[model samples]
Target: MSLTGHLAASLHDRGLGGDQASAARALRAVHRAMAELRRGTPVLIRGGDHTLIIAAAETVSARGLSELGLAGIGPAVLLLAPVRAAAVLQRPVPQDAPGTEAGAVALRLPPALLDPAVLRSLADPTAERLLPAEPERVGAPALASAAIALAKLARLLPALVAAPAAEAASGRLDLLSVEAGHIAAYPDTAAGTLTRVAEARVPLEDAPEARLVAFRAADGGIEHLAILVGQPEQALAEGSVPLARIHSECFTGDLLGSLRCDCGPQLRGAIKRMAEDPSGGVLLYLAQEGRGIGLVNKLRAYALQDQGLDTLDANRALGYGADERNFWVAAEMLRAVGIGRVRLLTNNPDKLAGLAACGIGVEGREAHQFAANGVNDAYLQTKARRFGHLLT
Candidate 1:
């Protein structure tokens, strides 16, 4: 197959293409736009009847805003992470307002007041400002564009965009063009080259027989760790469906014992449980910190949680989905180790779905849960309620 044909096939597998050819074109367009946003460059986003030029609010400049305004794009509004919005706006957000969905709040500021200082301040994660007395016109497409831009820039999911327009506008804005080759190359580049970098005997407090194996991607994007307990390779060799747990990395709870979530206990507990099993198990430690939004945004979500938002709400407020992880890497790691099937251990149905979608067979599920602590009670409840995580 040609390079274009291969790219289209991959995009189709990812559900981002209509067909191989069209998918290749779409991938090129979206990939170029995403790359532009990552570099703090403004890009044009159009959907439905709206077209807007947007950049990541975290890095967007007064000059950038001025450029968009000169091109008839602004008085700029910010589509903020829910917690950031609440802090910056200095008021309780109304439940019925537009841009309130997914813990996101859009505030349109006066173009006249948007001096360089103010624009720079908006870029700070900790900075706060008063919202305008009256609402700014934020339509759905603008919100979507902001979401998409932020997702690419921050590695968050469910992208959205925000503009300074007080009302919806119609027209085609030809600001940039992308080639199919560029689009086809992104997925290939992002998939990276996965290679096992290290392996060693790592006796854990709970699982003394554990072995740690590390796999690094060529892009240095994320490194996946496999914690093998009780000879999983031997068990699989004997045709036993070894147990498996796919855990996303959590810096706060896993490392700091943050009571806001149950990640640490789950990590330790999974190892302990596998230690008792004669057949053993594998725990794939993914580098998808904060559900693929990275650690900084997780802290931003923590701030929103302090404002009484639930976990899902906090993520949404930050312009991310409830969960943004994809399990293809887990499947690949499993395949690399010569494992074909397993009894998956998880509370998240999405994990099972993700692995299955990536062609890994889950023969059964071992329900895993930890008793909720005082700080994480609401967090656990939110997971079960909003994200459909199975818990008792």
Candidate 2:
């Protein structure tokens, strides 16, 4: 069935009405659009007064590029986040615009650069070849910026091939359509849609009496977990704040015991500390692997790191921010578990601010640094120097 068909059936089953149905439809469209972009297909993004069709530069196929060229609206352009544009153009671009961290860039997508492999090289810094041509820079419209944002959401490189959408061509192409506004609002909207779905008693080696509560979005997206050790919520009722840790899932480090980072120790140690606390605590295990850039992009960043770039710069080289995580979801999970105030266990100050911004009152910070394994010493140092993590 089509994505729209699935959404329509879901809405009908749930009997959603009015604004709820409208919001659900918008979320469904964005979700479907992400899936389409990942598979090398195009989607149309409609803004307040304009519309554009965009495809991921890293994944757009030859046929997709042909469709953009033949749209009969205007010449297709390449849109990249400002950091990436600087890397590709080998010069600094403007960063004065609001909400455009260092500003984004739009380059005219010439016919020569339309081949899938060529476009992939342009989007991925890890590619060996130089760009085929010196593309001219053009002003990026709002929808163009949205296009890059959509690529990032799809867990592809934050680069897009886009063109103005002709009404007739948009209809004829039968492309999935979503709103730029909805793309911007997706993280918080999806966070708001979460509800506690299930709970089970699963004692851990570090945290005996651990109960895992799973939170799922209405659309059945990835689930965030709350590992409750003892009585954190009970402490809240007794007017005492409990300990909390916001841990983004690290599959390599946490699961495979990769030595390039300290995630495994931090994760296990946090649980032990929370288990020992008389007040007890809750650990919000988020599914934001590689700080929310997704596992594949994280591995790409690691490849860049092997070439001597630090963690932060490695992420930038791949056209992502220093961190792409949305702590709003963590805040929502904490709120659901009746944890409004907490003594947070973390080394990164961003977690403190992130929770506070989302109305989660952080009582204080409990230092949680572990000794660096010989392999990850530089990685830990990079965290302290570049990301301002409190390692001491």
Candidate 3:
């Protein structure tokens, strides 16, 4: 591989060539590796994709292998092959190995190469297995808020990128021709010049970094968002500190007292912990509403729930994958928050591996399980028993 922009072009400009069923099949295959972390790659060869496996790294020493579990790399380590590869990815190949130089890694086929029972296994020794998940509902109200939030983004992202920079700083936005000037906010940084266009005041956490940047979308809608930052002492750590949290966005529960799905409770718990001394931690407070089914779908799922369906069944009936949410967004959010390492706060082992695949270190995990109550018993049980969550 000459690094001739092959992989980048494969992923970026060129989209997949397949029908709906093929696309779904591709995704479902990746979903299969939710059990043990497998290693492989998505080959863009020929008409169909294939997963090729690497065996050299899998032959790691016992000492190195022991670190795999105790490292607390979070959940999906066993399930997500890409994440598993990173968890066990070694650098500077052993000097004792023959013929190969140091750092010559043994790579594998991607999970997309799901078949291994036939001759293809000889060509690429890779396999796939299913892991599971059980996500609770974000309720009707939260979904509505999330819809509005996403809609606002859909309308404003273009203009905000084109708006004059002066307006961004002054909170007074001015539209200019896209060709003339562009005012794009750094995606990695949320603390740019914020103009109070809508006069919406976002309340804050006790810390100085706890101010939500409120602004008017180009659509003339008022929006407020709060960011929690660690203090100077915690912000600048010598080594990576592992951190994790079950961040349920605070549309109603975290802000208003809605006993819907413990979003409020979890948000409080995450903030309290994040406010502590900064150690590389994993806090995945995602913007995924109703686990990415969106507000309308979430409400629809709720309707099914009211009709005597379990939480998982309700989502399935509503044409969702039980967990429609993708953790990649959470991974990006964590990186934006200056989190490089983390001790994930979750019970779903899959989530751990997902974050690790996305490049966040998992030192350990702190289980976030709510006390059993009749109202949430079904939801909790599905998570612990069905979804493979480490509830106990």
Model 3 lDDT, full chain set: 0.36
Off by over 4 Å in 2: 1-18, 96-103, 132-134
Please give the range of 10 consecutive residues that has the lowest summed lDDT in model 1.
164-173
Order the numbered candidates by TM-score, best leading: 2, 1, 3
Clashes counted in candidate 1 amount to 16
Q: Could you give candidate 2's per-residue lDDT for residues 107-145 as a string of tens digits?
A: 777678788998898888887755644657776766777
Better of 1 and 3 by lDDT: 1
Per-model TM-score, in order, reads: 0.70, 0.91, 0.44
Question: lDDT (0-100) at residue 90 of candidate 1?
Answer: 52
- Higher-scoring candidate on TM-score, 1 or 3: 1
lDDT of 3 by residue, 118-144 (tens): 212221112222211221111111111
Choose 1 or 2, whichever is better by TM-score.
2
Q: What is the Cα-based TM-score of model 1?
A: 0.70
Better of 2 and 3 by lDDT: 2
What pairs collide in candidate 2? none
Ranking by lDDT, best first?
2, 1, 3
